[model samples]
Target: MIGDKPAPPVKKTRARRPKVKTGCKTCKLRGVKCDEAKPICRRCISTGRTCDGYGIWGGGGNAYGSVSRITNSSRSPSSLPLTTITTTTITTSTCTPGPLTSTRTLPPLLGATTQHEHRAFEYFFHRTSRKLPGIFDSPFWSTLVFQASACDPAVLHALIALGAVDLGKATRELACAAERVRGYERVALVQYNKAIVSLGVHFRRGGGDARRVALITCMLFICIELLRERFKTAKTHLGNGLKLLGEMRRGEGGRKRGGELVVNTELESVDDYLVEAFTRFNIHSSLFGQDNILLYTIAPHPSCADHAIPRAFTTFRIARLYLDTLINAIYNLAHQVASLSPASPIPKHYTNTQSHLRSSLDQWLKAFQTSLPTLTTHHPLIAPLVTPLLHTYYTMSTITLSTSLSPRDELIYDSHTAAFESMISLMRGVFETILSAHAPLGDEIPDPPGFTADMGFIPPLFFVVLKCRDRVVRREALELLDGAPHREGLWDGIMAGGVGRRVVEIEEGGSWGDEKGQGEVVVPG
Candidate 1:
């Protein structure tokens, strides 16, 4: 009777609500309710607990877990995430936790979007631009070229290609493995191909602006090739650019009947600037090659005659144009002399040309000297940097002109000796200046925008080491070369210096036979 009564008196139990899962990590772990405030939860703040902010995982959870936990895991250390921590204030509950994970990958090699163009341009302006200090300082690279590139797809591509090459070179140097270097090189090639395709299209279209852009692109390609040490390729680009300039000149005066201007209908300041750059390149290139073809084809600009040195002695830019003209004339004469048969006597025209060059050189030096005093008072930095370079070039011009004028049998040893002495003296001045400024030797020095070291000292130094008879002077020049490692245009200082050192070893080793004592050194270009 009792068991039956208990069964009939059983009571109903009420349903309980599911436990709410709401709170910051701190409050949740503490088993307390959280206000879920914007930043620090009110519950955690009131309880004096630090708030762990939220991230991609809700409730401030760590997806990869804590750094300590990851480090302690059984997984290999290399498998761990490459994390970089940066301190940032958390102002909201939704804020990501800890440091940011870098997800931004390098752009693809074949990418040719506007974003990539801008990135390439920035790389060029900051890094590669300094390699061409004087050229970049001018309005062309700094302003006009960029403006043209903005609208001209071909020019933009060419610029990006050059920038890519520079970046590749820079990265390749830092790369420890061959595969990494290859990767960068591939990227450079991709950009280079894009530029070439765009340039080809512009050339086919044929207009005045297109031609101008083509000329600029060709020049840039030459630079790219030279940096890669593809001398033959660089020469081809140089030749093509020279041809383009010729066409532009012809089109300017309507010389060709019914010939329309290809590129732009009218020339701009940029055209003149590009022509000047080509002229400079022509002069520099002639130093290594025997060709006087460029000299004959490209006439000097009329402005080269304006030899008035600025009172500040900062007139090297203008002065160099005139100096290059003189140097080119001398080089052509040397080429002519070198070509003559042994039986042939020195021509009257050779003597006349030598005399003319000497006279012009003297006039330039006189004006240059007159401007020197201005440097002492007005330009401390200019005086130290430019004085030695100007003198070195002057001495080199004199030596080259004088040596070429002499017959093989009757070498002008005295003139050679004097020039060598002058060169040594000037170089000493350069070293002294460098020491005073505490500048790094050669390529170690940083070349910011508008700042480039004068590379004029290299060729002359190399010449001395190869051709000068004085052992002491040769040693000094070699030491300078050994100390400085730089690359200016196509001239690589370290490579040149190494070659000079080898030549010295050959000479010292008595490999020259009878020529060693005779001071009859014949250096191959």
Candidate 2:
């Protein structure tokens, strides 16, 4: 009957719909129609499935396709699997139809992310840079340190470590929590260790850049140790820096015994800046323990001897040079006198050397006077206390020299007394200046960017308290020390002040004189 029905009427068959050529991975895998959407497809979102992103169809068609189809092509020949994407090409439904391609890449350092490094750099430039007193105002801080940090990982780490330390010191009080401070300390220590390890590697490798960075790192280590109050470590780092500098200078000529050619490198302006910093540090360190050998290594500039003075003495550089020379002479003479027998007459050479040094000192004084600024033409940049401080230093140096000649010589003793009086006067002037300006006293003042007690009126004041015999002047010096609570470089103002006061008590109580010798004064470093 069914075969007979076909003869009765010819029935038309229905045509099938065309299959979808393009869709997202989830829709294609599910064998469903894809409502193509950017980023995530609507079909996948509605059906609670993940969209596998969009790609151009590998087959010849103007429709979007799943990533698997485009990536698994025979022509593409990708090392990755069909499921793995090496590069992603994202397309939109807009008429302008080129795919946007993107590839992921890793950063440079494993733990040090770019964003974190940038924050550290910003901290260094704005804050840590200001903590170096003499160097901060120069390009050494603003330019050289930045340039060096960008290229050298050791320097970068050291810089960030310093910034952490500074931040800790600044915020420790506000935080009032040891844990917070400890957190910063841990960060600083880790970074410092990294710098040290990296620097050691560079040193072992040995290159011009290595040597330069080694010297810089050493200097920075010294600064870090000083900030931490680790004097012995600071000194060790300074010694290492000096050694590196010597090697750099020596490597500039000739050849080694193995016939290797020596690298002849010219120093940059930044190197000169570093040398100057080292020179100043060397002199300061010598004052602590009579380590005067640094003086021999760093000869005074020839220009220092020139009698003519410029119209204005705006900076402390020139004066410090002359003062350093005199200090060296004083220590040398003191060593010679110390070795002499108690009953022995002053040696002829000793007298000659003293005379020569005294004459040179006189000339330096004259030059200093000529270079000094007039009241009407004072440099706006130069602090008012600077001139008085210089005067006190000059007077102290003279007294130090005279005292070194013979502790018992009546002429020298009288000269020392007179000079002591002059120093007290200069110190009073400094005190007056601070008062007139309505500025806080040393202890009352907030710590400045690069503040150290020795940088202010404390060092010279302490010297007077330790060395001067006058009760009134010594008492005034002690008072000044009491008013200053800062630590300077390696010198702890508070501790030194305490020891000085104790020494004064012992001397005045006659206990020291009774135990040691009459008129003997023990000056603490």
Candidate 3:
């Protein structure tokens, strides 16, 4: 037994070391060793794996990723690469309530062309979603809207159409050539038609959530038309959306026999996300003199004396929302007061409201300044994304308030010349940041003259040139406006500058020659 069976001691086996957790996230996730690169790892790029990025807290995306899931598989090829719209050029769609939802796998559409539809979806995810939220962070564009898009063909097509318009930014030049048609415009029109048909089909079906789908589609329609620069069509879409919302509200308000709300919860006005979007569109539009009914009443922000305002804004978005509320209140108050006769004294209530709004603005500025140092720390892209824009908005809001009662008086703006000068500085810094941060993904991906669905720098810049009589400041504003062609909602920098330059010429009794920017801004045919 000892002779043959003194089994050579079983070969000793070395213990297995914990799997090496090195390299980029995608590589680490694949259980392969990583090269451990900064920002993005080369290993992932080499293998065509999205870097999924690198961070100390976790992998790519924010701390609060979206809970919503897009269960259907995408009809498009999975191999197509996603490009990032630079931090400065693209903004918002967040950590989901998520901008650009975490649900990467899109639900399939029954009749979508694999390549065409997929590219549109990708553009919206990477570009349009971010631009839609404007200065404030909104989950409507990033999360709920995507969810709705995934579920509804109408919404999907509408977004695809929008993506097409946004993608055509650079195509404007080609489009304006009399011999050629706008390539992207053709695509957008096709997709838009499809969306209308699809939405019609939904309406005919009349499902329990038909109204919900309608509201979502209507929002998409507004966005689609707005970005396409068809203000009349967008206005029509908004009117329809508002009408649908009004119907829902009236039904809720005029309920039946019992005290309980007889209206279907799904049909009882649009959900918070939908209503918020619609309300924002209405408010922004009406502030510029559009005849719109305010869907939801804005509760007046408590006066600073009434003990409102946080010690310091916890997030830039929160601060933005507070400022926007005040801006809307100021605009709304100004709107109501503008109707009064020039000889008449401002009403006591209106004066009180103005006083409160002014106080709130002061308090907001104080809080914003306190949090300025830490603002960039809120999100990785926060600095390029919102910092300059917020500063620009604050300056404009201050100007807006001081001239509230004097909307017709060009003379009043002279007092705000310093503020206008500051705006030019802010804009110069912004344009520099935009140029530095914006990296278009080669020639195939057209970077249209900077276009955003949100109201951005254009409105403020146009306002500066229109009201400020200081020729030097006005010219500076015009030059800056003309320098970069961007569309921030209805305010197209090129058109605004061209028209503003003409007005200046007439008012100054002089001619301005050769004032267009690097790219010829051809008006959309």
Among these predicted structures, which one has the highest TM-score?
A: 3
Q: Model-by-model lDDT, in order?
A: 0.56, 0.55, 0.61
Q: Report the Cα lDDT for residue 200, model 3.
A: 85
Off by over 4 Å in 2: 1-123, 134-143, 207-209, 251-268, 290-293, 296-315, 336-350, 374-378, 407-415, 431-455, 510-525
What's the residue-level lDDT of 410 in candidate 3? 76
The candidate scoring highest on lDDT is 3
lDDT of each residue in 280-363, candidate 2, tens digit only: 566567556545333422224333322223333334555654555566556657776877888999888888777777776777
Ranked by lDDT, top first: 3, 1, 2
lDDT of 1 by residue, 1-525 (tens): 755645465678866544438755666666666676522355554554445423211122221111111111111124333322122111222222232222121122223344434445556644454445432123345334443443455555666677766655554444254564465466567767777888887778787767877887787787778767676787788878877876776766522212211111111245555665676677667765536345521223333322222323245554554566677667877877988998788889789878877887888787678767864455444557667787788888888888886547334655487789789889878867655755321342233212121245667788788778777888788778655566555566667676776676676785433333333333333
Worst 10 residues of 2 by lDDT: 56-65
Q: Determine which window of 10 residues in candidate 1 has minimal summed lDDT.
A: 66-75
- Candidate 3 local lDDT, 1-525, one digit each (tens): 556666577788976545756665566657777776433355655664545443321123321122121111111123322222221122223222122322233444434354444556566776677666754556467455654554467777787778766666534445344322255566678888988898788789764367667887788878777775788888888878877766664555533222111221121122445555666676667644576655343221313223256668777766765665666667766777788899888778877777776787788789988998887665545466477777887888888877887757878878888998898888878777767766664554456566555667777778787777888888888888867677766667778787677777777775453443233344432
